[model samples]
Target: MSDERSYPTGIGTSTTDRIQLLGLDLADEVLGKVSFGELAYWLATKRRPTPGQLRVFEAALVSLADHGYTPTAIAARMTYYSAPESIQGAIASGLLGGGSRFLGVTEDTGQFLAASIAALGDTSGYSEDDWDAVARDVLEKAKSEGRKVPGLGHPVHKQGDPRTPVMFQIAREAEVFGPHLSLFEAIGRVHPEVLGRTLPLNGAGVAGASLADAGLPLGLLRGFALLARTAGLIGHLAEEQQHPVGPAIYAEVDRNATYVPPAP
Candidate 1:
């Protein structure tokens, strides 16, 4: 007699595996039960934050919703104008341009300050003298390296970035202060001297720091920034529909250039 017992080949394999992998069990759990707000609350908190926390989160989102036609917004608008049927494609085009270099300055700012702190060790606490020493050292290094401090200065906002103070205030109210904030404050103190004028925290810097303080991963910051900017991009798309810029404008062509003959 054969020693082996007969077993169906598909029984413990494909058929059973397919049934186990199917998510039909959770079907009823997700059927028209939650509104977007409720869903967002659930996802964010695993429950829900206090009303106050919700308000702060809303404010942050609202405050960052738009900032004119930045490069990303322009790209989005251009894509939308060309391909009106695919809004997602336009938005994706815009998002591709959104990165840490574009909208989140916290990592760079944190790195700069962290380096300064390490260089100045034991002198980076809350003490004014300690802070000043660190700032001076960082500033000198920046000067020598011909690099600007990341969180300071803005091209368009001459006086100061209006968003900076608001974010700092929000962080204070939320009672969440960490190394990012300390670096921001330190940079704020030194920026005036370094730039020969007062430099206010820009939106990117504030958003970066706030997200970092919230214990969010640095990689997610760019997505948040892009999401915030999408509001502005949509608005621009709408405006462009009303009053279009026509075809793309290019720099003047060099009509006098000599043409080379193709190889024989």
Candidate 2:
């Protein structure tokens, strides 16, 4: 064997004379030419998206960016309050809070939709009624298994999630609407019959379907949500620097705590 080591990556690389990303000149072809949203999709899929795909992808990103003082945002602000000097820590604290109850739903919904679609085998020429039937079966199986449907409801949006329809519209206009989205919409239509009363297809779930339809990898759906939320967290930190509510939040919770003795 020769005394040499090789590292291979399709993402990015740099040397003395040139920097390359996704087989393009990062300085000449990418910078000032590609939007950050487009660049993110290109970097992830190793394939440049069409204008429609980019629109749908970025819409998904924007939908998941922030939702006003969610636990992740609070965690970020509180971490910033506790460690004012470590901005990265504050951002990390926010991202770390993206779990099952929060940002993780993006991936969960995408995976659920994808799995349901895959189970249909040959899905060619599947009509709306066919998709609704598929959606019914999917919900019925999930109900039987006692699994909470990830993107079916929201805490605040009892009437409807405004973002859900907007995402569907964007996907429709972009012409990137695909099976995942079709199935999700079917779920919205037919879920009342399966699970009783209606639940709006929340934004997070719609974002997942939108991302999946945009041809992004199912596994990286949550990562995309986190990428968007990173921007939101930075905004929160900037506000924390200016108006500074982290301490107030901390104080409110701290003052409300009551001590309760454990049984001996």
Candidate 3:
């Protein structure tokens, strides 16, 4: 007598008659009343955020909204070149690159920080030494197991990610910085000691840690990264339309290919 597949969620529900988002009418109550960032947070966390929390969330979104010519952006632009008719497909192409190696660093960093923090015995009022020990132990364990530390080092920014400082500054102002950010700092400080090299804190790592500090769910961190990069990819694709570098991107790769002749 009852439909077996029916389901319900606190997030939102829709039907032919009307649509609702988190119990608010979509057309009359939610639209323009709440920001996209606030709506996204509520959809995921199932609660409206305070003004401070919203500020921190907005800061994270803005900090990650764009980065010029990243691999994701490049893929998006190239996909656009291949299928100029489908801009959405090109955006999807760019988002597909947000796995462990690229844009997914935010998620990875959050897990890494959380795991390391749990490994730390106690932190009722952690001292510098306590933070340093946990950070060093994390690096040492990773080294012994030949595992890569997720949130350290940047290829282009040798000293540090320029965006990292700004993100932290905002987090500090918003009072959202927490143990995750502290742990990240400790790891960077001890990189030379444990890894025998200075690996700057990259943007992905900071974004992850900062979001974690903001009390966001670790599992959804990747989604944030993807969202931010999607905005960036759109910008790249728009320029790609005018300057049209996608073909040249392919050409450059072709020019640099190494040929291996058959053994005689």
Candidate 4:
């Protein structure tokens, strides 16, 4: 016999379930009840952060909101220029380009650290030596496959990522630093010796570790990172609006072949 319980298969299943509809009640509680700025504040802090935390979060958002025509930003601006009449289309175009791998880095880093923690098990806790061993193993595997360690490098920030230290500092101030930070530090220590170059922690690593350390659901890690990146999307859209690119450029493309076929 099957060990799973089966739901009734009938017309009722096709109809909207009342309980599911109840989920929409929260929308009423939020919509128009609070000002947009207030709602944004509530969403970011979950329960109204102190002024200091608010400042930090705002700074982080502003710092990440735009980085000079990244793929997503450029796409959004170009789309907006082409379809200036449709604000949504312009924003959507930019969003499509912007978020490509930003959240993936955060999520993948979290998963990597989670796996490391799981591998260590409940043997007291990870000492520096223990973490070094884990790092070595991960590095060796990455080397074998010719893959760079995910959280350690950046294309723009060769010396080190400017945002990483800030986020790590914020996490430290929040008193939520944990094994993930330690693991990151351990990786930094060994990375130079093994890879023959210093590998600084990037913002994604710090953000991923901070979210995981805060006891957040691992699944939510990427969502939060995406939220942080949305600010950039908005900024890109604004820039595109100011310097609009029209569809006349695209309309000039020749659709017909220059030469006729020799025989048909």
**Model 2 pairs whose backbones collide:** none
| Top-lDDT structure, candidate number | 2
Candidate RMSDs in order: 8.4, 1.2, 2.2, 7.4
Worst 10 residues of 1 by lDDT: 18-27
lDDT of 2: 0.92
lDDT of 1 by residue, 28-131 (tens): 44346543433443354355445444444445555667777677777777777678888888878877876555665545554554555554444325675556
Kindly give the stretch of ten consecutive residues in candidate 2 with the minimal lDDT sum: 115-124
Q: How far is candidate 4 from the true structure (C-alpha RMSD, Å)?
A: 7.4
lDDT by candidate, in order shown: 0.62, 0.92, 0.85, 0.62
- Over 66-114, each residue of candidate 4 has an lDDT whose tens digit, in order, gives 5665666666666776667777776666555533265457767777777
Candidate 3 residue-wise lDDT, 1-264, digit = tens: 867886667877889988988989999999889989998888878888877677877777777777777778888888998999999999999999888878788889989999888756657598878889889888999999999999787778888789888877877788777889888888988879889888888888888998888878999999988887877888888888899998998999999999999999
- Alpha-carbon shift of residue 27 in model 2 (angstroms): 1.5
Clashes of each: 0, 0, 0, 4
**What TM-score, computed on C-alpha atoms, does each candidate reach?**
0.66, 0.97, 0.91, 0.67
Over 161-245, each residue of candidate 2 has an lDDT whose tens digit, in order, gives 9999999999999999899999999999999999998998999999999999999999999999999999999999999999999
Q: Residue 124 lDDT in model 2? A: 64
lDDT of 2 at 75: 93
Name the regions of candidate 2 deviating beyond 4 angstroms. none
